[model samples]
Target: MIPAAFDYKAPTTVEEALSAMAEAGDDGKVIAGGQSLLPVMRMRMNAPEVLIDLGKVSSLRGISDEGDSIRIGAMTTYQSVLDDASVKEHLVLLHKVVETIADPQIRHRGTLGGSVAHADPAGDVGAATLALEATMVIAGSGGEREVPASEFFKGLFDTAVDEGELLVALRFPKHTGWGAHYEKFVRVAHQWAIVAVAATVKADGGTISEARVAFTNMGDRPLRATSVEQALAGASATEDAVRQACASAADGTSPPSDLNGDADYRRSIAPVLTRRAVLAAAEA
Candidate 1:
């Protein structure tokens, strides 16, 4: 397969990138890591007239620690995060999840922002971002705005990021090893998760202080199982309590049926999978 002939522009600045997008209008596409876009283009699924490359935008690449959260530049590669000593110390769960993101080659080339911007519901970054309650900073023609993780995901392969906007960075609350776990269900590595769950818990003297539960590929968007969270909070960090919370995973989801697995099977297995993830995270 061959892609449609298109113009390419690599911008070194945020303003320049936005301006390029504005000029190209609807026919222009932003290229971050191109991990997903290239494949789509090759398949002729998308035929952009112009491709705005963000590879040279310095402002969109790096990781920093904010007062209460970690701010990561959009261009940060998964490999960089994997090797980051700071991320390992404070946000180990993120590293844990990244380990399961595609394979080493993809990790080396894929940008975190690109993954989120692609808005694949089954992506590890999508679910992990939701579980961490992160915020995505998007800069557009008018100005900059932020979207919370819960609201950022709108549907499969869709997000709150608007036209002529570049996702600049991702901000997450400072994590101090709150029991965190990410469990992915796939027949093999590098496959889109049939269903995945990420769980984070804060424990105070063996009692659950706080809990966050997010699911991947269970619906049109990555979902936060708030019902499960509420049930786990302040409950004993026991298998029984984890099981109880897991039991309600499908309380509000409308999971879709697909070739990988059926809706009924995913619905039933999600809870059990989530329980194991919760327990693993609680032990962290």
Candidate 2:
């Protein structure tokens, strides 16, 4: 289906983009890589009067190292992240997660900021970011402010990015020397994850010292499995220990019921995936 006609603005600078958004008000839409928004627009599910394009904004398209952490521009594509040595060395969980998102074509066009802002509960990036404790940098007329991943995702397809604001970048604290893995289950190749788990662990002398775990498609937003994380800490990094700790993976989740599986089915699989993710991460 064709999209409804709309006015387009390609702003080369963040300031200009903000101005355009302000002028369009409620009728405006900000587009990054367009991997998500364009599909919705073509289906006529969304028809903004003004389409603000940020592609020309050169500043929003690179990855930079910041000592203890790294900052990824909102417009940076998944391919770019995959190619960055810093990301591979410092943020292994993110690297693993991005590699599983769709295919090469989508990865080349999908931007981190776009996925994060889209806030889809099934998106692979959100679960990794939530587990990594990433921070979002939102730009608005009031200047830039940061929101932690824990508070950034509000609900299904919703986020903390308010009106007249743009997600300029994401800041991730480095998880160097940690074992990380992303375990995703899909019905077919390139399909959205039916259930996924992202885990990163820190171990010392074969014992788990710290752990962070989050889930995809297990709730309205990517959720941290706090109970599992607590259970994994100070535990042995073996299959038995990991499986026992992951037993409560579905404790507080509200997974959706669809053709792929029902809520109960998803609840049953959460622990299985969580155990796999944690054990693999511990071994990495």
Candidate 3:
């Protein structure tokens, strides 16, 4: 299917891209990587008056190590992230999760910013980022500002990035000694997870000192398993303990009943996967 005819502008700078978007108003769509946007356009799901391409915006694509955190530019591809030494050494949890997103070919084109901005609840990256407490950077006519991951995602296919605003980067604090794991349940290779869990555990003297747990496909947006986190904190790092805490994995979630599985089926498996993830993270 061919998309509707539209004007396109490849901007080399953030300000220029914002200007194009402002001019196009609500009918403009900013695209980078095009891995997500192009497909929607081809299917005629979105017909923008102008497509602002950020392909030439070199400033928006790279990984930089700040003193306390790693700043990942919005246009940074999944493949680039997988190859970064800093990410592998300091943000190992993210490294593990990125390895499971789609296949090699898709990874080379899909951007972390695109995936999060698209706000697909089933997408794996959101859960990992949410668990990591990453910060999102947004740029618009009013200049730039930051939004925490907890408040960034609003609902299914929705986010805090308003009209004429572009997500420019993501900032992840260094995990240092923390151990993390991403557990996904996929029926086939490189398939979307029916239900997934991201766990980061910090152990002290054989006890879980701190724990962060987030869920994918559990609600309208990536959700922090606060009940599980509270239950696991200060608890012994054991399979039984993790299992007990994970029982609340589906407590506040409203998972969808789709072709993948029904809401009840997902609720049933959440604890099983959460246990596996927490156990693996605790041991790491």
Candidate 4:
């Protein structure tokens, strides 16, 4: 299907992009890579008066080490994150999650910021970022402000990015030497996760010291499995221990019922996937 006609502006700078968005007001939409938005537009689900493209925005397209954390530009592609040495060494969970995001072509074109900004519950990036406690940098006409990943995702297809604001970058604290794993369940290869878990653990002498667990497609937003995290602390890094801790993985989630599966089905499998994810992370 052909999308409705709209004015397009390819801005080279974030400021220019923001200005375009501001000028377009509520009818303007910001696009990066167009991996997610274009499809929606093509189906006539969204028709904005002005389309602000950030593809040429140089400032929003790189990765940098920020001492204690790593800063990834909003336009940084999934493939770039998978290839970065710093990401592999410091943010292993992110690298692992990025590796499972669709196939190579999607990975090359999908931007990290774009995925988070789109805030799809089934997306692979949001749960990992929520588990890592990443921070989002948003730019607006007023100025820049930082928002934590927990607060960044509001609901399905919704985020903290307002009408005239743009997500500039994401900052993730270095979790060096941490064992990380992303457990995704899909009926077919590269399909959106029916239920997925992201786990990153820090262990000492075979005992689990700390852990972060979050789920994708378990709710309207990426949900942190706090009960599981609390239970894993000071527990043995073994299959039985991880399985017991993950029993409550779906306790508070309200998963959607769709053609893929019903809410009950997702809830039933959450713990199974959580156990696999946590144990693998602990062993990594």
Candidate 2 vs 3: which has more lDDT: 2
Off by over 4 Å in 3: none
Estimate the TM-score for candidate 1. Answer: 0.97
Using TM-score as the measure, what is the rank order of every candidate, best first?
Answer: 2, 4, 3, 1
- Each model's lDDT: 0.88, 0.96, 0.92, 0.94
RMSD after CA superposition, every candidate: 1.2, 0.7, 1.0, 0.8
What's the TM for model 3? 0.97
Best by lDDT: 2
C-alpha lDDT of residue 214 in model 4: 97
Better of 2 and 4 by TM-score: 2
Q: How do the residues 159-191 of candidate 1 rate in per-residue lDDT, one tens digit apiece?
A: 898876889999988778687888999988689
lDDT of 2 by residue, 1-284 (tens): 99999999999999999999999999999998899999999999999999999999999999999999999999999999999999999999999999999999999999999999999999999998889999999999999999999999999889999988999999999999999999999999999999999999999888999999999999999999999999999999999999999999999999999999999999999999999999999999
Weakest 10 consecutive residues, lDDT, candidate 1? 84-93
The CA lDDT at 124 in model 2 is 90
Regions of candidate 4 where Cα sits further than 4 Å from its true position: none
TM-score of each: 0.97, 0.99, 0.97, 0.98
Q: What is the lDDT of candidate 1?
A: 0.88
Answer with 3 or 4, whichever has the higher TM-score. 4
